[model samples]
Structures are given as C-alpha cells and as structure tokens.
Target: MARKTLRIAMNGVTGRMGYRQHLVRSLLAIREEGGLDLGGGDVLWPEPVLVGRREHALKEIADRHGLTEVSTDLDAVLADDSIDIYFDAQVTAAREQALKSAIAAGKDIYTEKPTATGLGAAVELAQAARAAGIKHGVVQDKIFLPGLLKLKRLIDGGFFGQILSVRGEFGYWVFEGDWQEAQRPSWNYREQDGGGITVDMFPHWEYVLHELFGRVRTVQAHVTTHIPRRWDEKGKAYEATADDAAYGIFELDGGVVAQINSSWATRVNRDELVEFHVDGTEGSAVAGLRNCRIQHRATTPKPVWNPDLPATESFRDQWQEVPDNADFANGFRAQWELFLRHVALDEPYHWDLAAGARGVQLAELGLKAAAEGRRLDVPELAL
Candidate 1:
C-alpha cells in the first residue's frame, strides 16, 4: 500500500477565502485526516505549497500549519514538474492571468468561482484548459452545504411533489468603516477592482438553482449601489462604484420561478446568513446553512386574514425540523476531496471549467438584465 503525494501550488493563500476556507478548513483538514483514502490500499497525500506575494504571511501560514513548503515565485512553482495542481483564490481581477499561466505550465487547475470577471474571459480559460487536456474544477461549495444536502435528499426522496417556486434571502449588514470598520475588503465595493453583488453572488445562485431544481432560463435583475460612499481599511473614505444590492428573478427550466435578494446593506432576520424557501404541491421546506424545516401539505395550518388583530398563532412551531441523519463535513473540504479524487483517479467530475463558465455566464447575463431593465435569456455556454 503506497501513498501518492500530490503537490498543490496554493496561490493567494494570504487572502480571506484562500486562508480560511481552502487552507485551514479544507487542505489542512484533509492533511489532518491523513490524506484521502482511495480504497484498495491506496491513498492520496496533498502537499500544499503556500504561494503569495507576502512572504511573511505565507511563511506564517506554512509554519502555523506545519507545512514546510512556502514560495513567493509563482512562475518557479508552476515550472516545477512535480506540482500536480494549481489552486487560485485570488481577487477576481487577478484570477484569469494566473489561471492562464497555470494552464500554460500543464498543471491541473482548481479555482474559486466567477472563474473570471467576464464571460468571455471565463470562456477563454475553459477553452484553454480543454485545449491543454488538463483536469480543471471550480468551487461550487453551496451544493455541498448540509442544509442544501438535506434539501437535495428531500427532492430525491420525492418529498416535494411539483416544486412550484424558490425564494432565497442572502445577506447581512456590512459596516461602512465610518464608525465601525467595514468587515469586507474595500475592493469589494469598487467596480474597477471587479466588485459587484451580481458578479459575486449570482454565480452561486446559478449552480444552486440548476442543481436543485433546473437550469435558469431567464434572469431579470435590478442592481443598485445602496451606499454611495464607504470607508476603507486604512480609514480612508472612497466612492463605492459597485452595486451593493441585487434583486433578481430567475425562470427555471421546469416552469419554476426563483427569486433571490442579495445585499450587503440589509440586516439579517433569518437563522443563517443565507436561507432558501422552496414551495411545492406536496410539501414546503425552508433551509438555512445547516438546518431545514418542512411543512407537509396535509399538516399545513390554514389561517384567516385579519389585519386588525394581533397574531396569536405560533406559526413557526407547525413546521417539523429535519434531523441530521448523517455526519456532514465542511462544504469546502468536501468539494476539495472530490476534486482531488477526480485528479488522482480520473473520477467523473461535473463541475469542470465549462461549468464554471456557465456560472460566469449567469452573472454576466444578470448584469445585462439589470442594465437593460429587462429579462435576458440564459444561453448554454459551449465548451
């Protein structure tokens, strides 16, 4: 029983998503679990090389995680024949060029979503990967969420007969850094730096809707910059050029209507930062990040409309909570494991670069719909 070590060049390891989700939670967790078991006495070991511009931050991360490999030179790392994968979680504007370099070096690629800021750039990346004949994947972590997994289980078990519609509420108030320091990066509010609510979140909605219900056929979006100005990390004020809020209506393939509201300006009222409510003929379910509650049609309570009186019924108590029947791993880590197996074992992976391009297409179309003030049809992206 021999263990196969796969070297991964993890660029942008100093960034928020890169450092937290990919490095600490996913790769490090995988390492802590003694790598991935490939069955039949075979295992895959992931050797991560921290790659970023800040040598001090990279070294700190490497030392914290007990990883010996750390590098600031991406070209040198990519040039190495032993590096099997190149993972990028850098800012949106920097992703395309890095991916192109990785592809040129003939490395298997995995990256954070949006793939690129624009559809054309995303398509080019996908086509280049295809031309290079290399394995590529994007992070579609929502589908791996415990709540979404339970919802998927319900759909698979036919709990929802004729799903009618889906409503998604996602967002939380982000401080403006005037009195309270802004929680998000300043670049997130600047369009010149590839920042917009539509670009950031529509890609996530696209996959969630497509995977759970059906493909999104059309999109009508109203995107706006709720806050015209914001303070930066250095306590400097700047004009917010990007849209901070996006209200979208998506028409699905199976005659299902989906609506999602994404805004950093809105306050949270739900159990989690994101929540989805799906209504169907047989049953209706509301799922958050890790919890799902369902109300069957037979057990649904009927209420009379009375605007003059205070509500007396505890409506929330009627829905039954879905229990966690199985242990759930971190969503990001789960996807990483799948991608690793796909690379090592040549396993079938549906979330390839082409799929990532589709996500980018959705975001592009969503922005177009917002600008034109009309519904735009989503066309399939040819790989």
Candidate 2:
C-alpha cells in the first residue's frame, strides 16, 4: 500500500516567521525548481495541507502561493483528521494556548522556541504533549547551523581537549523606532507583550551552550534596557520596558564557565557574528554564522608589546564556509528537516521541547538573578 503524505497545517500562516521561515523557505524548497532536489528518487516528501490565519490576510497569502487550502478557523483545521502535524509560530503568550488546543485535538506538534513565556507553562505543555502520545518538538535552529555543526564535530573529536571556558558574542543594533523604520517588531520592545531578548534569545544560547559544553548549573546575570524609548512603524513613540541586552555567566557542570553577551544595541560588525570562542588546554575553536576557525597551542603565538608588529595569525585562517545541502539549511529550516526525518523515519534528533524548556528555565534564572542581585542555581528541565 502507498504511504500517506504527511498533511501539515501551519497555524500562524500570515505571521512573519510562519511565512518566511517555514512557508517561503521550507515548503518552497520541496518544489521542483526551488532547488530542493527531492524528486530524483523514491524519497518521501510531505505536502503542506493547509494554512490557517485571519481571513482577509490569509486570503492574500494563499493567492500569492497558489494554495487552495486555506481557513480562518483554528478549530476547523485542528479537527480535520487528514492533518498529521500542527506547526505553530504564534506570539509567545498565545503559543501555549494554541499548542494545548492542538494537542487536545490529537495532532503531532512543532513550534518556535521559547515555548512559553514562563517555565511552569513550558513544562506543562511538554507534559501534556507526552501524555497525549503525540510527537512534539521545539525549533532549535542554532544547532543545525553548519558553523555550529562544525563546532560540535570539533568538540566530539576532542579538538578542544580539556575545555576551560566559552565566550559568546551575540548582537546587532536594531533601529530605535525613531526616524528610521523600526527594524524589529513593536512587540519586541514591550513587557506586556511577549517581548524581551532574555526570553527570545537566551533559550537559543542555552541549547547551544548545553550542546557544546554541558548542562549549566548556575547563572549570575545583569539585564538592561539600552534604548528607553522608540517609535513604532506608524511613527508613534512608545517607552521600552523590556531589557534589550542581557549579560550572564553560566557555570557548566564540569566547572567550565561560559559568558554570554546578548543584545540589540550594538553596531553591525563582522557579518552579525553570533560566534563562540572555546578555549581549552590543547586547542581552541571559534564558530560563527558563516564560518568556523580552530587553533592549536603547537603553533600558538607568543605575546609581544611592539606597537608596530603585525597582528598574529590565529583561528582566522582555519575558518571555512558552512555547506548548505538543502533549502532548510538556513534559519529554522534545518531544524525542520530534522523534525521531518524524525517524524517520517523515526530518526534521532536532539532538539525537543524538553531542551527548549531548559532554555526558558535558564533565562528565567538569569532574570531572577538580575532582579534579586544574587546568583541563581539553574534547575533541570525534565522530560
């Protein structure tokens, strides 16, 4: 008998992330001319069954994509027995509600990161998914980046033997919403809405650090709002309450320490490098969005204070461009590939809601530590 095609329904169809990350990139890639190369063999490809969103807006999107299956009703989509997966990319506060409803409807689930605004809610969602016997996953895109994949390879190969410390630099200045058009969404600068770098990005770093080093044991952090006020896309000014920058120190279980600096207030330099510098006894490696570099102590340089001396060679020369095998190899797309494989072939993939919950837990701990002016012992996010 021929296997059934996985009928996937995108819940937040008109949202930027839903359209850009999944629909525009992932689904488009599966088409013959989209460069996906999925037609050469007996490889199975799941088709997007439908997209659900607000009526008028979704109509425009559906027309643009030439998709006939579209609906404005969430319940109608979830209730459809033909749907095999429900993918959610709604705002943070609404994600739990939508996901809970999807799980109740007995659909397998996949969603964007920072699963919920709070740790308890995230955990509950995870538990609910488990109890419902549905496959569940959270998008952890960083791990699939070819640069990070190279870093993982180096780590597993013991290239950086006896690791000592890790440093992460993440940032790029977004427009303050004043004269220029606001670079990011308005919801990103408000507390009432599910906005804040602490929630949005820390979970990303949490997974990266945990994957590279080990489980984080504790955190001491400081968070700040660099730009106090900003204008919206409509030129209306609004006060920014959310912390735009977060600086934290993480204590890994094996005594390895990691320092992370995440912000939206820095100038764009070095190709928006969200790079990690890992220092170890034997050698060191640096991984960024586009490249990975490694250096060993064997050819390590000696310090000299000569002002006229040229800059010494280090990990820069070892850098290489990450290969892109599929359209999903960028952003959340790669994570999508892994999830699809996991669903179709029962392949092992690491990004899960449990790990995503931990990212939220880490951020929560960091925020608490900042508020109370004390170090916080990180709690394990259970499966």
Q: For this target, which candidate reaches the highest lDDT against the unseen true structure?
A: 1
TM-scores of all predicted structures: 0.99, 0.91
The parts of candidate 2 lying over 4 Å away from their true place are 1-3, 33-42, 49-53, 306-328
lDDT of 2 at 242: 93
Off by over 4 Å in 1: none
After best superposition, candidate 2 residue 192: deviation in angstroms? 0.6
Least accurate 10 contiguous residues by lDDT in model 1: 27-36
Clashes of 2: 1
**Residue-wise C-alpha lDDT for candidate 2, range 31-123, written one tens digit per residue:** 433322223343545566555557777778878877767777778889999888999887887888889899999998898978999999888
Q: Pairs clashing in candidate 1? A: none
